[model samples]
Target: MDLTLAQEAGGSSLLSLLPFLIILLLFVPLFLNGRKQRRQMQETQAMQSALEDGDVVITTSGLRGTIVDASYEDTIDLEIADGVVTTWLRVAIREKVAPDTTSEDDSADSSGSTGTSESKPTIH
Candidate 1:
């Protein structure tokens, strides 16, 4: 008997695996993407649940406000402006907004240079 049978057997096995390997490569990225999306959603939910009063946040609708009350199970009270409190679902919150530290420093510097009429107005 010739040893050609063994050589042909190995080649056929590799050829059979090609389609499976291609499928695996195709699905790996999708699996990783789904897992990443799930992790991000979990982080968002955790941040929303950890919300506290006085934390500034922005809503999905692009509304920025300070958290007035977060003790409610499903609702939160937000103050968008002075004396403008509104109740919204906790899930509606998009993310926490960091306070602008640079703006405060810029405002102070701009305030001192206010003698010129061309000086821009400083916002509190």
Candidate 2:
């Protein structure tokens, strides 16, 4: 009976630690998911920065456009549709188009003028 009592004490002590262990296990996956999301954001930013004129990009708001121009000031000009031109800051641009397709071949042709250091034009 004395040995059985000692064993019961040890079992309860181990059971007391189980909740803490379960909480730690749950947190581990959340931490790893956050890391993965951060990495994806960095990758997306890098891709956005690589955007140039003629690269088709989709905005965060789901506005698809071809990048008509890119500048050092973190802004770009987009032509969302035929005869439509708009200027948006870099943060507004989202996904980039797949490479190797020429923007010249795109049937949705829109005309736009590139902004310069000396001029700011009204964009649609």
Candidate 3:
């Protein structure tokens, strides 16, 4: 009789913990994702604040340019072309562009064969 009561008590204890376990499983991922997003936002803010003249950057709108002036408090002058400078908000800058690798990629692409593998269906 004591063994039966112990088993029943153990099963009830586990059932009581089941809801807590389910809630923990559901919230842990959300909490982690929020932390990750906050970290990314901090990194982006740091990058924007660290901008200076002569840094080559690409804008959020896909415009690639060099930073000609960044002395303003909330904006920067980007030289997109010779004698063509544009004023953009500091937040518009996405990231600094890496050194040119277009030529290398172009050479590799041209050396490979460009072909299609589609075949026409045969009529019986």
Largest lDDT belongs to which candidate?
1
The whole-model lDDT of each prediction reads 0.91, 0.83, 0.90
Clashes of each: 0, 0, 0
What is the alpha-carbon lDDT for the whole of candidate 1? Answer: 0.91
TM-score of each: 0.76, 0.74, 0.75
Clashing pairs in model 2, backbone N/Cα/C closer than 3 A = none
| Residue-wise C-alpha lDDT for candidate 1, range 8-124, written one tens digit per residue | 999999999999999999999999999999999999999999999999999999998999999999999999999999999999999997768646877877787667565567754
Local error of candidate 3 at residue 93 (angstroms):
1.2
Off by over 4 Å in 2: 99-124
Model 2: per-residue Cα lDDT over 1-93, one tens digit each? 999999999999999999999999999999999999999999988987888898888898988888887975688999988978899989887
Q: Give per-residue lDDT, candidate 1, residue 14.
A: 100
Candidate 1: RMSD to truth: 3.9
lDDT of 3 by residue, 1-124 (tens): 9999999999999999999999999999999999999999899989999999988899999999989999998999999989999999999988987556655777866676667554558743
